[model samples]
Target: MPKSPETLLEQEFGLIAELVHAHARARPRHPALIDECSRVDFGELDQRMDRVATSLQRDLVDVGDAIAICAAASVNYGVVFLGALRAGVAVAPLSPSSTAESLATMLADCRAKFLFLDEHVAKTMATVALPSGLQLVRLDHSPGVRSLEAWLAPAGSVPVPVTIEPDAAFNIIYSSGTTGTPKGIVQPHSMRWAHVRRARNFGYDNEAVTLCSTPLYSNTTLVSFFPAIAGGGTVVLMPKFEAGKFLELSQRYRVTHAMLVPVQYQRLMDREDFDRCDLSSYRMKFCTSAPFSAALKADILRRWPGGLIEYYGMTEGGGTCMLLAHQFPDKLHTVGQPVTGHDIRLIDEQGRPVPVGSIGEVVGRSAAMMKGYFNQPDKTAEAEWYDAEGKRFIRTGDVGRFDADGFLTLMDRRKDMIISGGFNIYPSDLEAVLFQHPAVRDGAVVGVPSREWGETPIAFVVLRPGATASADDIKQWTNSRLGKTQRLSAVELTTELPRNSIGKVLKRELRDRYAQASS
Candidate 1:
């Protein structure tokens, strides 16, 4: 890791502000951002960010202050984020729909001095007494709270010299905790740029127009956005993901690239309106967050021809494994290979390297790996290791196996594995079987505590439009495809399965609910 002061202004600038400024100078008149209501050129974006930074400095929010961004995915939110980064503040983007209790907990945990709340959420926040020393800054529109727009009006655009450290905390993205309170993952500016460099090397170029259909607060979105900006690409922002609108927007903007979840891809393919749109503009499409079934992968390839790419990574380290479009023929199920500059290993509980075709925990050493969990040294220490050979690695908490060709195949999450009748069953295997049913639109598998088997597999399924399937029928379908140990003991038909903002199944919630009911 290079020292922050010396590395801050390099080609791969460590500071987020430097990334934005580099693009602004290179492409001043280029369209940098486009939301539903507004568009900003690189020049305007740079100037606005300067003004926002000036306002924060004038308000006495000095360098190293933590700022919480709680706004919808809008143009203003992006501006505020860049400004805060430029002012040398650690920016934490809070989910707009997070509960007041969760918000309060996160705010206090991060020790944020300024809270930027969207108008709708601002009103709800006002009813609750905020912790002392925290200032509420309203975004978009709200009464009583200081508006971001109002604050920027008097602050003139004068570029301030910001001293930045590459290793300084840049952002704190809170993970959805399954066992306890959500922990904030502390990512440094240099780590972010490392991913950006990797992304650029993977063919994201300056002329690319990247679409932002995923939530801006998502890890995938951050990975794509920073790289797009650093490479002087335009960002087409969507406030939320809507299957119909997403297809249309891609054509409207001639979007060159996009990142999507498997569910979104399924929904888009099922929509009759999707085929009518001109989707030829998309050149590259990356899928992450969840595994796309082989059939779904084939469908996507058939639909988009050569545009699909599959990547496997976690928030702790970005782009650990990627299966490029070219490698899909030989390794369709593989998460490609370890990305460049990353060392991947599959190790057993004994800390020895597992043989090929054997499942073990996936560990990686990458330049883009996170520094550690925010304020959680114990957890960090538990997650990382230094081998006798002097190599450092971060355990992924995911179970995977490598093929003879060195391709990685994901088995299951270590925490989500089901033990039924003393046999281990991965939920993904059951979920894949359930998705094979034509009537099943979405499915999630969870292990419910059972006195007889120790743990029993249960499934929650959502049906397709106008398709009604009973739980027994779905269970029968799953049983036909899976072995006895992997088959679901019970199935529940629901309108929808609960998912986090990033579209990951909230299996922990399902497990708890079903475990309680069975007890």
Candidate 2:
């Protein structure tokens, strides 16, 4: 690491707790968090996190034990996460938007003895079946749940200190298994440390103030959130996202940085008064976790002021690719080359290396790879690929071809591809044709089971505001432009598509609902 004299954070990368302590002492009054419910400065955040660590030890919680938290984004949410790190305990963050049964299953997967809940989560989960002898406490008051305040240690209480190593478990983030039960992806301290180190290139520092609207549990959000705090910068959190409000905060806080998904950019750009905001302070912005259209990238580059960079990687921490859209406008259609220290390559269905620039699945190896899926060694192994010399790589499940320039142009997810008349069809190709129409605002194509073709392409689209072009009109217009095998059998008009918490379109939900409705 390069030497810097800015703050202790530059030198305090061994454990996360030490960095928090350094920030608290160096700049006590620095605003560390701005959340929907409350704002906390560096000193108060450190003290509260210390209380949590001490409280856990007082309750006989041992180091390396897991603490489970299912809650909305808040200052308290940040407290629990930082505190667990302080006490050398791993935290399991469950998805709040998951079904009750699914949530219960994940809780069992992590095997946490104690579960923490936000007040709102307590009301809904109060009826869900949980393991016997597992204690549940709410962050704040709830009608029928125990409050966390009663369990917290005194303000001056100190936690027992322990040495932390690189390989110790940091947190378990569950995968969004669109097909079945989710698997817990175990990230270690070393992996997290690598993330912190990688962040330096993005310019996260004491002067930086990051705006994070997405949920804290999602790794999509954390890739940006953790870096700011680790660098002793303030993090502004939003409980929910609204375009007008997002711009308003950007103007009010002179927000220096943000990590938003592609959909949020679409909504912001779609606003009529988007250009009116005073956003000159923004130094950098990031997008990931969903398909970012080339057109949208061009539009944002034409309008938004900040440096826009898109990241392409899995939450499992395989090799990562970065597209600096601002610098490579000609390469807007492609996600940029692999990040440093990451070896990315293409492989065929049989795991054989494809020729350079050929379309194949993306597999990569990196220093930041996950420890493994918690307690699922076989499932963990299933996601890895071993090269000829036996170096391991993680499968990205997406098909793409690399250009001579080393930029990767994605075709479609392996599971999302359609086979019609024994020919492969990429939905993105069909969607690109659909987006060419002036009336088309946002579009997605899914392969639906068909009697004649085995599986056929079906398009769902949201039209531009005030546009009245019919679905049949779009279907005909798009089909005329696409190749025969990739043509959409039908186009459905909708106000909006189903999406998850992080703004990823829920195509599976659409397939299930529409397929049933048609049947």
Candidate 3:
């Protein structure tokens, strides 16, 4: 029988590096990771990590030190992550998609002495500003950057073992900067262990195969990435998101599990060959990082062969809610209840609990919560909420309400809420109505400055292919169905909605681009 999660946590073999070593011994030839460029088996992966750990020690990088990586997702990056973890070094995976200034800030914040950069990133940094004093090692050969192959320890070298406490710092995941400058959220080994443990409940095991298409830097992808390793399963990664490529990989690998954003799901289902692909091996489909619609969930359940689960939480790890769509078909519209040992509640603007079922800001505390923001106590304090009994919870910045059966139905982000004419309006409610229209492909609404009502919602929409619908036609049709205060001021058509690397719509960008006085 497999070890219980609690037992696994308490045991001496609980360390991720130790677990990788065990897998190396028992299943040396088993393919541990596969990417478009290459494949790594358990034994090879273990040895590579050892070399990385040894090299870090040789460079005088000690426990608690951070190492930064900015590159496209690949098999090489995975080995670097494991190698750093084994050396008791916290690995900070910086998003390559971030602007040069943002990248420099994050690199400086983490203070990573060693950096592993892919060729593309290195070239970009050369033209833009680059962090000084880093022992730069390129993922591939570059003119000025040292090759990663030349920096590794000897093939047979082994690293000295170091004690890793459960509370030891693991990784610093910087936020996506949805509002402004991103904050680095510090996640500990214990918090990550909880994620691995919780993953077993989703049926991850030795035979499982997880397909991850999103960028590795995002927490949305790691929710599945780490578990596949912990479960002793094969992980397939993609360098970038391409609908046709994703389908081919899923069918070729007989991928049994996936953690994708809603936008990804929408594209996959829209593919002409979606139904032709043999995805019978799939057992679970996990989603997070953005909203997942009930209508889309229903469509997947009808066509996709797997249990559909939606996770609602932030990277800061305060609290997470799960909606097991496969189990609660009737509650598809709700984001379901809290997972085991998670506490979720809604609070008014004053930080006081609101009446049950009334909409308010979502606050939660869980075993998987992050330690705090790195080196920013004031920012960390701002994110925290304390109850009368002095129990602590993290503010999710999302507004939602719970039903009689404990299912949560999210309204909008606290900052995203629009107050026009003394009434609060949620953009999600309006977005849902937009999706209902057959001609509407996808849409987003943002509050534009208004002289008459202070702030009114203006929408941007993408029409379905070959569907001819004027902006005025869509605006009139949608406005008629909305409540008096919730109507959109106007609708502007677009070819596509802007999204970040993790597929969350860039509403801030939309508002900035279309900044205009409302009628």
- Ranked by TM-score, the better of candidates 1 and 2 is 2
Model 2: colliding residue pairs: none
Worst 10 residues of 2 by lDDT: 2-11
* Tens digits of per-residue lDDT for model 3, 151-176: 99989899999989877878999863
lDDT measured at residue 175 in model 2 versus the true structure, 0 to 100: 71
User: Once all C-alphas are superposed, what RMSD does model 1 give against the true structure?
Assistant: 10.6
lDDT of 1 by residue, 86-131 (tens): 8888888876655565577778778898888877778656556677
Measured against the true structure, the TM-scores of the candidates, in listed sequence, are 0.78, 0.80, 0.80
Q: Please report, as a residue range, the 10-residue window in candidate 1 with the lowest summed lDDT.
A: 1-10
Candidate ranking under lDDT, highest first, comes to 3, 2, 1
Residue 124, candidate 1: Cα error in Å is: 3.8
By lDDT, is 2 or 3 better? 3
Report lDDT (Cα) of residue 26, candidate 3. 71
Clashes of 1: 1
What is the alpha-carbon lDDT of model 3 when measured against the actual structure? 0.83
